[model samples]
Target: MTLDPRLNAFRPDLADRRLEGQVEARHFVDGRPERVTVSSAALRREPRPDAAQETEALFGEDVLVFETTEEGWSWVQLQADSYVGWIASAALGPRGDGPTHLIAVPRTLLFPGPDIKLPPLMGLPMGALVTVTGEAEDRNARYGLTTPTGAVVTQHLAPFGGAADNFVTVAEQFLGVPYLWGGKTTLGIDCSGLVQVALAMAGIAAPRDTDMQERALGTRLAGIEPLRRGDLVFWKGHVGIMLDGQILLHANAHHMMTAREPLSEAIARTAARGSAVTSIRRLG
Candidate 1:
């Protein structure tokens, strides 16, 4: 029997066949909200290690848990961007309450103690949601973050919901970060991930993939208009943020890193590959 595309196992439906007495209804348990527990968690298209990763969820972000699999994965939709996918069950935990800070720098080390000399507990990437329990000031450092498990430098953390700087400035910070298929952190990132993280830091909410972003962001520009900084350019399955009318900044496998290149060069190369620029959007 064929399953409805929208009702597939990944989307509301748990199995291909509806069992007896099962209403086949989608339900949300409001009492059991989940949040990403790791520094970065992978959201995959299927509930398996080998499944294609669709996006990454930053620490402390709320997730709508649709269902948990016996195989140790949870079908969830990320609350920040509403991207639905499967994530490892262990990467999530009870919902964290009131995250008041966001990682503002490209990356920051979380140390086991306030002293920088000690080993680091973890590293959080820019845009990761965090809550500061306390603060420390030492002669060695100006400010330190006192988190539940450890502390991080406060200079890298910023108050959430504050005014955002230019999106292009944020995107440039990842210029040399390696390209990862489904990454969203400074360690590595994908085309959509680069755009999403940069926009999020600019206090803008964006979808997780190229197509979803094309539909949800900015006014589409006609072919005759000039591209500008902060404008988004999209091809069939890839995307890039315009550094200016002349340069395209993107994390791509071709360069194996985030790079800025002439927009004309990108257009010619992509056209040769049959994925020419499909849309250009400018966001205020």
Candidate 2:
């Protein structure tokens, strides 16, 4: 069987030790584990800063480092979904204790202390993980102490294993977020990114790109009839969520933002662009 380079940690010169006998490489070694330390870091196709960004590694996500170059790039595979790419070495740190909670809202401020009045150190996006060590109450508001420093609003975090009741409802929160290629956060997001992030909040694991998602997610539907809420509609390189039988929601380049519209309208627009819906899928 052929292994996908994007999903497997392998290259012409080096490969993960785990794939020792499965692939050809000049050398194989065990990869070291690391954690993303920045709020987010771009995973690029090449080591250069100008290379195409394939995805973003959110804060506290785990990655297995296979190689680190003097130029400060590290070839790593994301533990969340196993996507492989080169990320900045500086963005990673020792993998400490496992995360205890995930940011549940679109975005939240990471304050230096429990008080909201203090300037925030940074903003953590939804799905960013953190190890909550304790809690504090100030001015009747609650905050969660995260690791070595910083505090985040307690209400914005959900326990690691907790899931939202409906993924569609979670997707609805980013109705107007700007469309961004290779983006995964609410500040900017793309079609698959929106789907992936929302489904994650609902405890669903999904791949990172449209084609990968089309092949890996849900059961493909045949007739496209009686479309209900939470159905996924796909085009050659695009995807949208069925808000119901009639409406579609997606972060689209056409709108340059997450938008909702009639499914029929989206169908017509896509058809006018010389493409047709490739598949419709329903999650069981």
Candidate 3:
């Protein structure tokens, strides 16, 4: 019964108080809740800035901070997917009221005021959460007034709990986005990141890596069954979503970006590299 470090806050010296009896540590403490305040903050495997980034904490996502170091790093676990890692302390703040909305589009500008003509404060990626206090209209475009200050295009946001009809369509919107090993935003994304983010929009809570996903998601299809849209295809360490019976869409290193190609071509290429399709899963 080994606990996964990626989902548990534990180290040789310290651990979450909740795991008191299950794990051994020199000390344990109850973690304080916090919220991500930056557009995106790298969750690294180590506290150092140069450490390998394992994932990202998007703006407004809640987390439990187990420890903070003088060097400005915080060991925390994301509330959305339970991934644990070290994030910059500055990227976190007091967890206020829960988020009211999430960015539904690939990305949207956050203006300083209600007017779109003003310089934008930042660009919020899809899945970034925000608390909309009210609405404002300028010229013809409408905006949602976010807490503290900042305005975002009203149409680009969807209320919390609102789910997209098809997660596959959400994944399709990221076509051509650059491939990145640990990225989860439109600027760049990885295979599992793409799947996790897209499935989230459709109200499906998925794990963060291909192995986790392959084990936890949907029902496995038999080798002889016909493939269809939304089926997930897995290889040794990679994954892709089926666009239809014949096409596969994924953010892959081979393409260096999100791309769509015939499933047979992907199979041939992967097989040539000494891997074959390990499984196909159909979401229930």
- Provide the RMSD of all predictions against the true structure, rounded to 1 decimal: 4.0, 1.1, 0.9
lDDT score of residue 126 within candidate 1: 91
Model 3 pairs in collision: none
The superposed Cα distance between candidate 3 and the true structure at residue 215, in angstroms, equals 0.7
Worst 10 residues of 1 by lDDT: 14-23
Q: Model 2 lDDT vs. the true structure?
A: 0.94
Which one wins on TM-score? Answer: 3
Ranking by TM-score: 3, 2, 1
Q: Considering lDDT, where higher is better, how would the candidates rank from best to worst?
A: 3, 2, 1
Model 1 over residues 1-284: C-alpha lDDT tens digits?
Answer: 64323223333444323222343534424324788878999888778899888788998899877678799998776778767678999999986567888889999987877788888878888987877888786777754555466777888888988646787899999999999998999888999999988988888888777887898899999878877888899998899999888999999988999999998998898889887888999886
Per the 3 Å backbone cut-off, how many clashing residue pairs does candidate 1 have?
Answer: 0
Error of 2 at 152 (Å): 0.7
lDDT tens digits by residue: candidate 3, 1-284: 99999999899899999999999999999889999988999999999999998988899999999999999999999999999999999999998778899999999999988998999888899999999999999896899999858999899999999999999999999999999888899999999999999999999999999999999999999889999999999997799999999999999999999999999999999999999998999999
What root-mean-square deviation over C-alphas does model 3 reach?
0.9
User: Which residue pairs in model 2 clash with each other?
Assistant: none
Tens digits of per-residue lDDT for model 2, 1-284 = 99999999999899999999999999998989999998889999999999998899999999999999999999999999899999999999998889999999999989988999999888999999999999999886899998858899999999998999999999999999999888898878999999999999999999999999999999999863799999999999899999999999999999999999999999999999899999999987
In terms of TM-score, which candidate is stronger, 2 or 3?
A: 3
Quote each prediction's TM-score. Answer: 0.89, 0.97, 0.98
* lDDT (Cα atoms) of all candidates against the true structure: 0.81, 0.94, 0.94
